[model samples]
Target: MASMELTDGYDEECFRTIVLAGSPQELRERRIACQSILLEQLNVIPIEEWMFRVNTMHDLIAETAVLICEAQMKEAGYGPPPCTYSFIVFGSSGRQEATLWSDQDNGLIVEGEPDGEKNRYFEFFGIMLSDLLEEVGYEKCAGKVMCSQGMWRKTLSEWKEQLKEWRTQLEWEPIRYLIISSDMRHVAGSTELSALWQKAFYEGFIDNEELSVAVLRNTVRHKATLNLLGQVLTERFGDYAGGFDIKYGVYIPLVNIVRRLSLLHRIRASSTLERIEELERLHKYQHLDDIQRAFLLAMRMRVNTPFSVQNGLLISSDYIAESELKNKQLLSELRESLLLVRRLHRALQRQLRSAERWRT
Candidate 1:
């Protein structure tokens, strides 16, 4: 395997050399090689360090891919982009919490009028960028959240309008999209665009009682993976039978709680740990340090385990083998983590109820 040691600072040229050296046919293989090298080092690093490094690496890959796509478009006789644009990533990548395997959950925020010509320019740009990312091993999001989709590729004004609709309507799907968009972080292009959108988003939900309740209701829908018997809840059927889904069961509830708290507090930090720290700094919640510790433990378990993936998307199995569960220490840690999640969920529910009562 090639040396996986990252250079001391951002090395744009080095990334370009690696990415641009390969032909389209070989791009996927090269990307996998780079990812494998990076993955090899993740096991030994602290979870926080691993997240930061991997996020930085992925950012480099995105920048390089955009540059390559620009060249490809120019060669294909397309003119330069009509206006400034920002590429925003959401979900785990946006939160800087991506595991070794991830799919693209991204969108485009173009600064231009809502005109057909401008829309077409961005449309083409989104497609090229999405294609380049796929060639480099980032699978298209199953949710169709990629910028290549019309709904996700939009002008700044369009995004604002969409946010308005999402906030005002309070429908399930729109609210869900709004929650996901809350994680948006600009990875490339005009950095200010995402900030503007986020400002609008925060302002939209800050004093909206209805929206807050709806968000809380949606967030608490995912039950903790631990059953009443204090045993890890394993899948009863499917290919992953006997394996628990750590992603949805443990990681996502924590994420949802952190996200809702950040919204409630009007905190802008995107990562779960950062949000927790910010909440702590404000003395907003009790046992935050313990919560943070539990979250990191969960993250470590996530990175250390080999997950099953299908079509390049992680299959949600933070699967602990039955044998590993039989080990007292391992089982104890797992139960403790799940218990923490349950406690946190209840605390959040109490907070929500308090806020709702105050509103009433």
Candidate 2:
């Protein structure tokens, strides 16, 4: 009986051992578990506790989720064959700033034999992978903009065709796709897939005189979060009792504006910071550098905070309060970033109008 009791205690200790393990792999696994738990529990946590807890959890879960997708792909026979493929993540997931639950936004690029079977297999694998992700935690995209959706699943030729068609339309929805697709990052699978897409898109679309104008128009849909007096804007609901949607209210605008500019020039870098650098190299907007730096810092700050968890629960980032900005540096930087985004919006609006005239 004593031996049995001791053995049970050892088993319990073994389970806890992962959390305390010094190895990177062990800590990574533990982080994944902890992140999943935090995401599951974010609704109940107070806003003050957000920074450390929320951001950490978001990072862990994002990587873990991607890991799961890769494994599922192998199981589905979509693993790359000698050649290369890229499991591109788009939108929030692509940015690596995803909260507890974000919809599927992804694309694929493949460079393999034109064997119809291989293309079909890749599409089948992506669908299964997206479905598995939904089961694990992520919600299916309402518009079906997931790997599981037929529209989003495509071969290299199909993708090029779709892009050309969308460009020809130059409509609001297509413009939106162009912006979101700019955030893509190769998470796993064949790296070649992303490379091919990047090469093709940058070379084909950036210089397309007609498509550039449409994208610019789509970029400036919102105004600054602060009014002329410099007071932050409030909405009808959320934290601050009535505050703005930080994700959409601030971050997305910055992301969208930068993306439009980058895509217009075909910069080919997905990360915002990298995009900013690329823009600088192109000498497109010199005065905007400070603002770009501030915005990138704000995004880092927000993603590093726990508000994402709570925001995920509410299905919105607006509930995040300015009062939660306990760190003065982060708060100041975030505010500056928003202002920069606002400036960029105005600039984009003007550019779009010019582009429209030029097109005509």
Ten contiguous residues with the weakest lDDT in model 2: 1-10
TM-score of 2: 0.71
**How many clashes show up per model?**
0, 7
After TM-score superposition, the amount by which residue 194's alpha carbon in candidate 1 deviates from its true location, in angstroms, is 2.1
User: Candidate 1 versus the native: TM-score?
Assistant: 0.89
Model 1 per-residue lDDT at 149: 96
- What lDDT tens digits, residue by residue, belong to model 2 across residues 8-69? 34333433543354333444455445555554544344322332344334334444555555
* Model 1: lowest-lDDT 10 consecutive positions: 1-10
TM-score of each candidate structure, all chains considered together: 0.89, 0.71
lDDT of each: 0.77, 0.60
Give candidate 1 misplaced runs (Cα > 4 Å): 1-30, 307-318, 350-360
